[model samples]
Target chain A: MDLIRFPEMSRGELRALRQTVDGAFREFTRIWGDPLENLFAPLARLLTFLENLLIDSPWILVLAVLAAGIWLASRSWKIALGSVLALLVVGYLGMWEDTMRTIAMVAVCTLVAVVLGIPVGILMAQSNRMNAVVTPVLDMMQTMPSFVYLIPVVMIFGLGKVPGVIAVVIYAIPPVIRLTNLGIRHVAPDVLEAAEAFGSSKWQKLRDVQLPLALPTIMAGVNQTIMMSLAMVVVASMIGVRGLGQPVLQAINNQYFTMGVMNGLAIVAIAIIMDRTTQAYGRRLQKHAEAGK
Target chain B: MSAPQEQGQAHGIEIRNLYKIFGPDAARHLPAVKAGLGKEELHDRHDHVLGLCDISLSVPPGRITVVMGLSGSGKSTLIRHVNGLIAPTAGQVICGGQDVAAMSDVRLRAFRREKTAMVFQKFALLPHRTVLENARYGLDIRGLPAAEADGRARRWIERVGLKGYEGYYPRQLSGGMQQRVGLARALTNDAEILLMDEAFSALDPLIRVDMQSILLELQKELRKTIVFITHDLDEALRLGDKIAILRDGAMEQVGTGQEIVLRPANAYVADFVREVNRGRIIEAQTIATPAAPGAALPGFTVKARSKLDRVAQRMVEAGAGAAQVRDPQGQLLGVIDLPAILNAMVNSADAESEE
Candidate 1:
């Protein structure tokens, strides 16, 4: 017994295990990569279309639309004006195209995450077994190094916007999924019983009662997903995603301090705008629960 | 409004030999439970909590049958059985000649939609939905068209005195108003069987009385077969045409308010009725002496259905020693003296036993 030096796998054995796993994954990717890339072609098109729509639109038009959207979602003229001013500064700083690209990528990533996450969350909430199985998977996804998964993703999709989107979504989706499950599970039992007592089928109960009541919490989850996706922008740029993150990556490599800070500030501005708008929207949804207090 | 003839054909619920054991392997413990295993012993030995033991009740059509018990006495569990919200470990809940426990998933959903509505103690209105929307929830679940559901919901909202608060959310309203919305929601379903699980228990005492009056007033017209659960003896007396008392997951007694109050089935039931006002529950006819045929009845006559307290007041007002108790048809049934009323009012069953 080698108690002092903990027993471990032999170096040769470890090397053999690594090579075997790598070889198997390489073979798997060769066999399945084209089909997987084809399946995501439409998503790539959607992302490219959105990116062009944002970047190619007249600068003032983009600014006004974003301002209007912020106003509508947040119902706050202050937030809308602040966001518009921040975007103007970013534009004046000559980072307009990069900021737009980042916004588009984050938006798509958040949408995909929400669209996929909520159903999985609802399933997890409905059954204890599903919850048990999915909770650990979510933990692993969140805790594992992001670069560890990127290798397989890169091998399959080759390096581009689709792989970047997949990477960001994997990194960002856990909050929405976790929060959606939590929100649905936290609905008052009596209210759920009332729904059943009124002959609400499972679908009816979910759509009418669970979804509406859980909306605020789910909105919070979406907010968190957007924030997480934005946080992953710099990391995603390493996989050839063109965004504000690219300049930051270049700045890091070339040691240009101002470029790094400026691009980093642009990401922060977008994060604040998204965060405020969604938080305000969630509060508005819960206005009924707060009224007459 | 349904015709009286059609209303007369409404279904009464019959819950028979229902047993609910809450645990995994609940069915395996049924033999031991059926062999007279007590609730505590079953819990200690088998790790199975007995929810209800051999509960059998007949809830008459167009009348309120209140199941009275403390929190853990399985009153809520018993009400849930009628709606098939909880499947019994054994036995049947028969409504309209069909066993609720035996219903298929689709059939049970249809049955609940078509035949039953429920009111909850916590006023479980959808906080997101406005009062009108909450009221219309049952109809919406039944897939009623939006316009019709809204119209019917509006009518019931007004009927429940929540007319102006249609757009108000549940949290914005007081407990009483929220419960009114709950009642409107249940009534708008147009369900024959209305299940109220401690519906008014969450309200203040005065508000509870007001809600009871509202229920009684509605029942007069709607005549829905209502199963109301309560731990408050006064509420049971006020609302129940037939009251079933439960203790420790077992039925202690089942009878009219007067029957339970005047002659309790056991010491446990006697102890329960001890604090109840006998004057309010006991009827003049129940404690009256048999009068000879063709005998001259007292000038002061009270209806046999008149509660003892009312009978005493009338006798006192008339300055008569006793009053003749008359049936609803105004035919004299018996004579009830003031002394007897006083005796019954002051003397509990335990006191009588001591005497």
Candidate 2:
């Protein structure tokens, strides 16, 4: 090792380095702020109960999930059959219980994200300054890589299910905001002009014309939000979220070929199931708008 | 430009030197704008488009004034000033006695809610609401109880022949039907001044005629002051009590149908009238005089308001020496023979036949 010595830093230089270090540390703390009643304890409890409960009744959970996939595939017996077979295979190889736990987590996480995310997306779409300010922060949240987000979230919320959910939301919310802004901004000018001519006030125009017209695209955003939440499931396992991903990771480590394959199939099934259901809902909304027009 | 004087007439609207220029560069160019410049003169001087230039016209109570122009002729901009949807860059839009251009936002809202309603070209019924609900939206915004608004909306819907379709969404309706809903939405408010910006322009031609008939029936009953804008000359001739021909943001002429067709103020007005079927537009009451008992009269019953060309056609059709013209009360006033029709056409053509 070449041991190199430099002249000791002046006091101001030392202070400047301290300030930079302090600023970065402060940012780290802010990024993962307060998550117990807000974050960790309840989430872990919910995750543990779901994980344990699914272990108690894997077959029921698996069949219940196939129902949505069937409904969404919409009379496609082949796709429905294929989806059900996937769930059965996951069950046969003994990862079915863990898969259900992951499903429950995703369902809970997506619901929470939409409720919170939509209003924020609406707000972001509504104001230019807010969109300008929020968009970069969202970009940072998404682009920071999956592992970097977990450390602070895990540190503050401290190792459990709540950290996992929060981490997923942070990762997934950007698409919802981006697409929502784009959708509302893209409503036809002629349509909006008609609303104004009708003497609809600002609020009425937004509620009646803007929102209804922008709905199809917003639903597309919602679908993307849900897909992103699912992507977070596998990454969430490192923070001790004991879902299907844990079994997949364990089987990979242990070289249990049959086990990894079954768990992987279950993950694929969950993604396909969620994707189809949300897409169906989006189509229904599109039809509703067209019918209204 | 004429400074406005109080009209002893009881009109619902009186515009005085109302100007709408594009923006900041307008004031700098004002010195160069004449009272009314030719189209090319305007294009060269403004370096900006003139929308409604120093327009001063009126919409009389119980009458329809159709402001006729081509697409960029500022017909829509002129109507917006009447309802206070937009303020003029110069001059006043007087409704009853209040100046719409000077009304505060709250007052303008109150005025729009109470005294004026507008129909748009695209039939902008709310997609989220059913026909009845969309029609009631204006009333609902003014804080009327739902029951009251819906009751009134139902009546208007029935009036517009949309009774059975009240529950349908706008998308469920056909284009003509959707336009009826837009019409019903405006009519439900029962505002005195109805501003229709190409109200039936989006409908099919046959459907548009039906809508015009419907509007005529409504006007007979309600007697509202109506200011309608259209690029179509025939629609104007059919519906207008007074039609103002606009060319490049200036009024070419403002007069009744016969006044424009028989005696257009300028060539711009003449070209618009030339293509219109004068026989269909000019009424028997317009051109008829007290019947001359001893004249060699044509055997056709023609109206005094009948255009000279039409009376001539009737004369040709009848193969008579002259045609008898009548007024609204069935009084035969004057004889229009073939020579009279040909002479009138030739002499009027001499004045307006453009190079």
Candidate 3:
């Protein structure tokens, strides 16, 4: 028996497809605007409160944290010495305790971003419906006035390190999510398909295929998040964050030029350390995935 | 052991009346499905597209079924169903006695974890993990301890001939090496069914052939039920036990390599067959019959099942007039000469003419 084949799509069908896509794009852009904007200060306060809770034993915590940071960031003794000196100067400037508090807040915020960001990125990569939903959400997160994000958190959590950390997380999370999604989507479809044929479950596929391939991008996100968190810290101190931001803000307010410059240097040092370490980790992941191939 | 494995052996994937329409109106327009009158119909008139239209087929145990078509053919969508990567709008994918379409999230997860493996054209190894770790990832997702997963991953890495470079990431590897790792990753999962979506199309010609042979070697022993998707007629001929041609989300034809080549049911199927090197595709075991001539004082002979391509090549290269054929035990079976080949060629043409 003979079988029949369909002809190329008719012109009318192409027009319909174009319309559907155009309509979707329009809705997407429309949804990208801020759904909320007046919640920055309350969010900043909430970050401060959160910071206070995690900073119970400032000196010891600072020492351990600094050492670990050195171990992870730049293992060279000179860099470690520099890191230590940077901290001692902050202390001498009467910002010792505050430095520790900010460090704690930054650390907690980084952890939160990593934890929340990866799964969502994987979900976006795996589902068309989910991605369609998330694309607008991501667009809004990235495009909304950075300060506007803080308002809701400030209102809910109230001023302090808690609100400050919240603000940092909000700013820092988008890159991580965006990069992670890109990496997963770019993973060799063949490799993931191979994994599927091997009977990998969704999580298995993500952990095995998607997450591993995406680690570099996710790591890039981490680096971005860290830099962003540091950037936001200065902004956060305007509310009540005690660490470097507070001193910098106070220095600016009081016209203490030397103090402002010195505090800014400290934040810069922290940012450099976090950025370098995460970048190194990302490179390592890229190398690892290549090895699989 | 025999009882458990026998009970566990799957009949492989069976897809039935699958429909994946892109627009929201797909379900609503269900009763109006017609060839050339689907998404393209809506799309041409209203800019809508129906991605899939009632795709159905069964991949039997230990068989390689190639889904062939150009882009927009819905071949990829059909493969996706076998592994439950995309749920059909309306249909069932039965595998290992389970209706994949009806599976709950947890069941789907379990199915993916244990039953299916896939390979893509773009060798998707995890960038962060070392080759060993990437291989272990499948095991890891199933809750295997890191140490145990690593142990098996190491073995697969070696199997794919990537022994010393366990620590390198996906980016550091060459295209071919990455694909090897892809193979190793799937091997590690040891899933009974393997789905490939143009997995080698991205590779260079030489590397693609090498990979094909490697796949052959792996499948010879593993005997996994494999459903491979590709537009390349040569690839389909080389790898498939059966081939299903899809055009616009509908099956054009499904048959064994010989069946499709010798008797294409439609013009679309014939179009693909005409492009293949027939001598390379049909085998001695397939068309060779006992002729009176190959009785070379009687014992020595090529297996009747020897691939015709191999036999034909030996004939051309050695300038031999005829080739002897044998059976399963290598017993002298028959002689096949130029006439047999010419006969096969004519039959193929007749099939195409019928189409």
Candidate 4:
């Protein structure tokens, strides 16, 4: 029976182990919780400020800004107009403020992911040991169920925007880091050898040769991170993140089909806008690669 | 020969008993290699590839030294040692009396920055940077002010025949043009040593010849200590003031092109020189017979430095059976007959072995 079914820890032993781990984690949070929260206070403030700015602005002005940004990124009036129409549709459906909050959350989470992820990626690219260590950690981050980690995060930050932001960032950051490392590593070796022969120091090589060459790949990573952040918004709403996700969560609990479909379509609209704008931007960044060929 | 000293003091590079073994346990196998474990045997026995072995050569300043070999012959590895791009397993690279291998990382960087510039086979220009920006990359690394670097870079860009393409990126340029940019970038550094690792091997033959001419023209003015690597015997003959031959990670012979052609050090070199156009390589003086004192000089005269083919053409034009080989001062060095010139031109290893 033990061979067929898997042997397990006795109930008392399992309970004792769980109690010890839970107690230790609780103690750790009690000691470190306030300082860590304070450390993230500025991030929380930035998130709040961006959300407020988006929600409080005249809808027309925000629409105009988004249209201009899309136009600049895509260099096509059609894409910009389509994105503007999609945002207008989301607004007309009465999901305007919730959509704005989701946008703010995704934007802030993507920005933080890029800021923290690129350096980590560069470090991994620079050393075999770092790559060996970080690669498995990234794999685990991507594979681990988000809800399992959410328990600890919610306990520490106590069900607010910061923990939600942290959870989204945790879900989103791996792609950027992995792709940045890949991009930098994929830079032509002969080019790197040339830089070295010309006496470029480590930092100079990274900045001038590796980073610029890796920009297109890094942008792709950024796009993936943004998409992942949006995907995590609903999961994040379960921990008190207020967004279009909240209505979807409510509709799920109450079995309200129209409300769920409307909110889901709104999320899809934003994803398409972001995906097209960023993909276009990434393509533009690699114009030199296509110019002569 | 002891005339007045020239303007710039010659800073020749000398490689002394250098050996490079590739693998984690390279240092452990150095003694066995020094004692002459063959390259194949060492690789088979110890799993260590010999990159270079017991290489000793003097690269004279103000002249091009071409290291010639086919693929896997260690020609590329040999040039990398000069710039400290690859550390030697044993021995020293002495340039301007400074040991390159002994320098600290900081000092090596300073040395490479101040004294060396390298051109690669692939024309490794940064794809993202413009022609002008790429040209000034070395100066930028040295932290030169932007204006000065731009001025110098612009001068070189024009010098290398890339005048109006300042804003164009590398991908926009043709392969030959990209190599031109590579050359301009290296020249812009104004470094003392120019290391070219098969710099034109990737170009079309016509373009390669064009680039070779440009390099020679530039070398006439620059007089930088150039270490050029190539597998092409023709390029080695054309550019090298002194030529070093490598075979299976060891020095085969090092001399003037004519010396190698006339007197190959071993069978491998003899085989390599077998297909060479001997008339173009063997100079008139090298094959000339010593003239007797007060003997009547031949009616046709050719410079001692002129290749036998030119001497032959001139002799044919002058309708003479023989020609006098003279130095620049017009002093007769030797006499060469038409028959001897033809004989030397078609001479091959098999013929010599038969003799």
TM-score of each: 0.96, 0.81, 0.71, 0.96
lDDT of 2 at B199: 92
lDDT of 3 by residue, A139-233 (tens): 88777876776765565555666666667777778887888888888877656655655556666677656776667677888788778877878
Query: Considering summed lDDT, which 10 consecutive residues are worst modelled in model 2 chain A?
Result: A32-41
lDDT of 2 at B80: 84
Give per-residue CA lDDT, model 2, range B233-334, as digits (tens). 889988999999887788899999878988889877877777766656655555444556675555677667666666676767777766677778986577
True contacts kept of 1: 0.93
The candidate, 3 or 4, that scores higher on lDDT is 4
Task: Tell me how large the interface RMSD of candidate 1 is.
Answer: 1.4
DockQ of 1: 0.78
Model 4 misplaced stretches (Cα beyond 4 Å): A1-5, B1-7, B348-355
Give the TM-score of chain B in candidate 1.
0.95
Q: Each model's DockQ?
A: 0.78, 0.32, 0.31, 0.72
Model 1 ranges with Cα > 4 A deviation: B1-8, B292-295, B348-355
lDDT of 1 at B29: 94
Report model 3's TM-score to 2 decimal places. 0.71
Native-to-model Cα distance after best TM-score fit, residue B177 in candidate 3, in Å: 1.9
